[model samples]
Target chain A: MTRLVAIDWGTSSLRGALLDADGKVLEERSDARGILKVPQGGFPAVFEALFGDWMGLEGARCLISGMAGSKQGWVEAPYCACPAGRVEVGRSIIDIDVRPGSRIAIVPGLRDEHDGVPDVMRGEEVQIFGAMSIAGLDEGVFVLPGTHNKWATARKGRVAGFRTYMTGEFYALLSQHSILARTLDADAPLDEAAFLDGVTRSENGHGLLHNAFGTRTLALFERMATPELSSYLSGLLIGEELRTQSLQAAGEVVLIGASALTQRYALALRATGTATRTLGAEATWAGLHALSGFLDADRNPP
Target chain B: MTRLVAIDWGTSSLRGALLDADGKVLEERSDARGILKVPQGGFPAVFEALFGDWMGLEGARCLISGMAGSKQGWVEAPYCACPAGRVEVGRSIIDIDVRPGSRIAIVPGLRDEHDGVPDVMRGEEVQIFGAMSIAGLDEGVFVLPGTHNKWATARKGRVAGFRTYMTGEFYALLSQHSILARTLDADAPLDEAAFLDGVTRSENGHGLLHNAFGTRTLALFERMATPELSSYLSGLLIGEELRTQSLQAAGEVVLIGASALTQRYALALRATGTATRTLGAEATWAGLHALSGFLDADRNPP
Candidate 1:
């Protein structure tokens, strides 16, 4: 596998790792080119300022992933659909002529329809494929929980498809912007009992899309505490979500997408059933590494 | 019984009706001095502008209810506790050393604790009795659905007490200010099955708060139409509310409060159960009328 430039560019920052053919990080530098900040003279200046000093970067090839490939980022490379195995994701690179740096290419993100639902991803597609490597590539489910949590299914080391749920974002907005916002403990953690209770309730035929405002009633007339009410609200959401996705996900190993914001979901899933395990953000490095290998293999047939 | 005055003043408008010796609308007038706007304006201008012609309103005593009697309204008056029948809801009959011809007495609204929960009411106390009148004034549960849907229990024409849920206000905020707002059908009636479906779903167990984002999920994943989703969401919220309150209410008739908003709630209730009925907003008026009769009986020594 030829060593080139590795990039993990997300919404708030651009991180580039200069690697050797052996996939060793020789030197690394990062800049603020997050998706949210791109409109303010993003990716180009940041990439230049951070990697300009790496001599090997002058002629080496470039492989990038993350939101930097989004329509709003450094170079808008439309996402590629899956069966993406790292090689296709990392190797099908696109060039950003904005800067002079040998042969440059960006790893395409992932988007596909699964079970009649449309799904999408930007930088994390590479990481997902990467994580599949160390975790051992096989048929399974991969999750990345956040404001917009992604749940993807892969078979034979190729991502079959994925879907997105704005549960976290909705929770955040309702917890802070609307009337319920006044009652939320913005910093509180999940109430496990509440989550388990939610799961328990769902099994009894409770539906998420049917009943979300039970939170206020519980608090107002029932006199349930605020924190507990919030947890219950989250539980109903996560519970309903699990109910929606679980049938198709049975027996598939649940690879929880972890970040600080996702711990609650991880906890909820534990009680809600469906075998699961955790992989942290740092694992994205592994995802990046695996993508590099896939890119190499794709470019040179055995 | 001498004829008196009737008033219905709210957040944005002031309505005054001068009744005759038999409690008929002799003359009426209204203005834009809802409490939120003229918080500092005294009642003289408001009353004069509307009922100025009745300066010599002979044999006329006036009775008033609403925010006009709030702490910030014309004259500050404390609330009367529940189970309170025909309590003066406004400032006492201070002679108009200032007004000259009318023995003006503002009916102070009622307030009270019911079932260990803190509760209060102002303009609606009379409406409670009015509704109770139709519901048999026997022991039963009464619901005044609106921006603050009140669930009150009454025994023999007196308000036992009630709990307020910000159902209407919440529906407004969510559908207009929050993302859920995007799903509403500008032309759809509240009678849509989807709305009732939401109410049913609310009662389904996971409850309303659980299914709050169902509209969004359905739209995003299935490309479900918006107006249908809106009706479903509405049903979901109100349904959860009804479910919770039903349990809390036990076995009592749901005497609904009146207004455009209350009517929709009545429709939703009719779709679900027969224990619900819409009550007039003028029960407070009739109760005040009854109170006026009670007052007259006291004065005449029957």
Candidate 2:
């Protein structure tokens, strides 16, 4: 292939990277046009307007990840069942009929089940693959923190299973819309001390519904200020998410996300005596680049 | 007093009852003007507009409960500490200056602390007292469900301690604002089976954030209908709240609220093999009336 165009098109934003055959990012572009923003039958126009020149490169191929593969996206790329690795996910990469003689594919998401209930992740799968590749490890625990946080276990490069926590979304709701919003400054930056205090509070054996009310009471009692309360709220949620995992057994958790979110996770993880290593946007580019290699084998079987 | 005016002025609504010396509600009136709805310094105007006729009765004395006594309400009634019975709360009631030569008192809310973190409730304390008075039981677990659900334990005619659960508020947020809202009809009436299914699911030990995501998957995979999802979500939240309590040790729980909310609590409690007795608006009136009698002793100290 002359070039690989890797795209991470999620619910709220879209970003793409141009990488050489060696998987090094050469140029990057991003926009607010995520899958949800793209109108029906508008994906092609949007794609061409943003990345058409890059796609015009001789023998160039593009791979898109995230909600862009959902049923509501440009083309519905079905989810790959859990215990998926680079090979399983790669084989499932579906080619969409966007342009003639130019290969364009969407990475399928991954779905895991626990007691007949399903949990899913789309763009995060690529990041997981990228993290594994970057860390040069075959087995480990991976965490992707965002609007929805995912905790997954991988064995020999295959994600065995995972769970999703609505931690970030919940933080947004509680700090912005719930009764707690009355006293919290949701836009305040992270206060490490207040946050750790919240994390400590979560271990008090009273579940989240009960613990969350303390946010209001703490402020009402003047035990915590409004700005710090948001960080404290964040800690409570992140801590609750961490509570569900056997972190001590998992060893060093690999965290993948924006620096701000990963930093918070790292802090929360360390508070539990568990260690973490973080990766950023590079993981998405690397994962897409790695997945692109399987496209040729899928199109032309030996 | 020859007559008593009992009022439950909460966050979104204001209601009052005209009672005889025997504590019987002779007449009632309610308006959309809750404490939050009342304009600045408008409490007297609003109260006079709604209950002026009742207050005009000979020898009538008014007692108000709920958020109307909050710092933002008509007057700030300081909170009474836990292990408080009718006497403690009644003694703590603050008289608000509204009309000359007329008596008006605001019931103080109750505060309970666990390990330095405080949980508080205002109007619900009256309902708990009312339920105890109506059932002739001085000690039991009393649950008042509404925008905020309160679970309290009373012993020897005093509320020993209680916890607050944002269950109802969370149910509203998830069903109306979160991504799950997309597939749920928040206005649909309760579906007992679906609700019970959610309650059982809560016992699976995965916690709420993970269990809540099941709402999306169940709909995505065609396992449950959109309208029924709301009830299921409600069950999950209520179930989470219940999971924190020792229901078997509490004996028969007294549920106090509207028929709709109490009915749901009853259903959930029965699912756990815990017996429940329900009370309605009468509890509020009865609670205020019982406390009104204490005012005479407080004033005369005899």
Q: lDDT per prediction?
A: 0.61, 0.89
What TM-score does candidate 1 reach?
0.64
**Over the stretch A29-107, how does candidate 1's per-residue lDDT look in tens digits?**
7776577876566566666666655524444656778877776677778767766766566556676676544555677
Candidate 1 falls in which docking quality class? incorrect
lDDT of 2 by residue, B1-302 (tens): 48989999999997899989888989988899987778999988888888888889899899999998888988899899999998888888888778897889999999999887888999999999888988999999999998888999999999999999889899888888899989999989999999998888888777898899999998998889887898898899888888889887888999999998989889999999999998999999999988887567355322
* Pairs with steric clashes in candidate 2: none
Query: Stretches of candidate 1 above 4 Å error?
Result: A1-302, B21-32, B54-56, B87-121, B182-188, B203-210, B221-223, B247-260, B293-302
For each candidate, the DockQ is 0.12, 0.82
The deviation in Å at residue A145 for candidate 1 is 7.1
Top TM-score prediction, candidate number: 2
Off by over 4 Å in 2: A297-302, B297-302
Question: For the second chain of model 1, what is the TM-score against the true structure's chain B?
Answer: 0.83
lDDT string, candidate 2, A48-133, tens digits: 99999999998789999999999989888889998999988998889987899888999999999888888899999999999898
Interface RMSD of each: 6.9, 0.8
The TM-score between candidate 2 and the true structure equals 0.98
